[model samples]
Target: MTVPKGKLIIIGGAVDMGSNISAQENILQPNYIKFFEQGILKRIITESAHHEASKVEVITTASQIPELVSTEYISAFNHLGVNHINILDIRTREDASNPEYLQRIRKADVVMFSGGDQLRLSAIFGGTEFLQILKQRYQKDNFVIAGTSAGAAAAATHMIYRGSSNEALIKGHVQITAGLGFIDSVFVDTHFVQRGRIGRLLYAVASNPGILGIGLGEDAGLLITEGSMMEAIGSGLIILVDGRNMVETNIYDVEIGAPVSIENLKVHVMSIYDKYDLLQHKLLIKKVVKVENGVFIKADK
Candidate 1:
């Protein structure tokens, strides 16, 4: 089967929720305190075709405060001058099968999932026709799927539900479950740095070394194209934990709650504009300039 080249915008939360200012007033304001100042929203807008006419649907199923989440996105999209935005208030599995909701999913150019509990999303949408349609649309059309925090974490087949940053290296500290299965070979963890999730991500990699661990920092995100090529964007770092070269791991043998041991796991830290090739399991280095002793210098030969 030929796979479609759909786009995914995965964000680590804390994107402008700190705003005390009004959304309408902050439309063009570039102040640091304002929302959408982090360029992630703009990047999302640019990814959609015919920005002015594209229909964007916001799915608030993961959020406990669905109304608040929906309103924020609505305001942000409006500020970005995008018309035809809809909010899918799908709170239950029954709602997931609603024809009206299914039709909305059919016509949307971009479907965004808000941050909340990832479990809520899986429980509500699992095995539903709505989810099947969404997956079909993603696999066969020029569609875009965006998610933040929990939303981002649930985009993969194996999801991190409960994991402690403090005790992440312990054998039983990290808990993972099945997700929406959008991407199967990658395990995603959001609010990476802010929540001190590196240890947890490493533990996940140690246990399931076959997959890649993506630790997304707050206000940071990656724009994935053609399923496997990811370009980093936003203000923070994208930490990739690659275990393809791992030499040893004690996770399987260690008793539950015991500290786990791992060796030779590869780690990659990327900044804005960095790109990664998942198909080849390689980082694509870019030719750029460097600063040497207060002098700008070219790094590319």
Candidate 2:
């Protein structure tokens, strides 16, 4: 009964979406005065920044008020020509549970959730009207939804806000909040290998067995679609922990920060140029390779 939230574009954790870095310039599309088809988040932001037609929405309620409402962070939307930007600080507002936010959720062409508290973001829209509107907009292809860090982590059906990776992947209670659930059977963890979060994601995957775990490094993400396509993008690697056929010991007794003895937990990492077929549940030949660090093997021998 529950489907994916929408098409998703996740940027690896800790990206300075507010910085004036020149590299981010490439992500901006300054010109879109007319006809369009592509829906890259950056492209949409750039187009909206210069005009008022496109809507930019942000939901960051985890950190302190000042942090959640960082003007620098808000600039990410302003730069994209977003005439109207709403910060769904639902943590502070009980009204976020009301249907008013749904109206904004439906109108937004680019909905972005800022980085802060993944747990907060989840609690805000976990099972509310806002989530339904997000789903509706996704089905229409009239929007591009993206996130960074905490936001990125919650982009999948299953999400991990915080945890440690000391050893055995003990299944811990992950905060399953409201995210746009754009990636089905997929749980996401930001700052993957770099943060040693593979364990938490692995643990979450083990609990669901039917799902896949995605761990993204800083500035890296998996651009996914309900149509079953996944594109790895950004500066880091996207680690895939597949447990469809995993065999393991009793994960129930594992303690917080305790490790579980897991077996047959397969791992795969991909790059920005790579494409994966989710429906087929395998990497497309476009470029499959055994990888190390974050660099993958070249397709050509």
Candidate 3:
């Protein structure tokens, strides 16, 4: 059977919530209030299964602190009034194969992966039935798979296992490994601008020109529909590193620690409301809207 495409909500880390921040610190800040009141979790809840009968299954396998991460997600989702929420703490390969956990994946309308070590996610659930069914559901059913940070990175086929910002551009500096393979056309990175991951993402695209690089900034996310068009949401930026037109490179000749040389790398900075066409490798500009005399109107063509 041909697997149908589903939506993906890929969030960068440090998404705003009251869990980590002290109440006293955010009491006087409007942005903090907004962050707590209407952040990515709200969006996730809205896009998940039917409001009256939604079933959200959160997988906290990536995190070392699974209990804390699961609790935070439950608290956030609960605020949105999702009907049912469950956390699958599949810590070991044996845990991944648990029949109950497998049933949870089969019945969930939305499956969310929490942030932690990407390698742990890959190592534990790489070839298990749980992952297979999850992929199948995403392919054949109207399922939603949302992930943040490490979870976001592992959603792609090719994942960046490890790399340093300082030496990212140098050949052999970044390590690549097989990920869950939910989306295969692009390599994803999170905590992007906040953590200075541009270099590593650039290198990933440079080495494999066939794939595009997505760098999601902290507090930002990309809501992808039909597996192609991406709508940027949240408070930060989304960086698209397109190397299709790259003209020059010295990667093969360079030493391990030598700087990489390349030219004509195209990049697009997308913010909230901006859309990106992944298949065409282009940014889709929306109709410009303007405020005229306190009235909102679309700009004339």
Q: What is the TM-score of each candidate against the true structure?
A: 0.89, 0.74, 0.89
Tell me the tens digit of each residue's lDDT in model 2 across 127-173.
76677667677766546677777777777776776555674254454
Tens digits of per-residue lDDT for model 1, 75-139: 77787788788999988898889999999889898998888889998889888898898888888
Model 3: residues with Cα > 4 Å off, grouped in runs: 1-3, 21-33, 286-301
lDDT of each structure?
0.80, 0.62, 0.79
Give the lowest summed-lDDT range of ten residues in model 1. 21-30
Off by over 4 Å in 1: 17-38, 287-301
What are the per-residue Cα lDDT tens digits for candidate 3 across 146-265? 888888999999999799988898788899899998887789998898779999999999898889999998768888877777887776788999999999888778888889988888
Q: On a 0 to 100 scale, what is the lDDT of residue 30 in model 2?
A: 22
Pick by lDDT: which candidate is best? Answer: 1
| Ranked candidates (TM-score, high to low) | 1, 3, 2
Distance from true position, residue 145, model 1, in Å?
A: 0.5
Instruction: Report the Cα lDDT for residue 144, model 2.
Output: 69
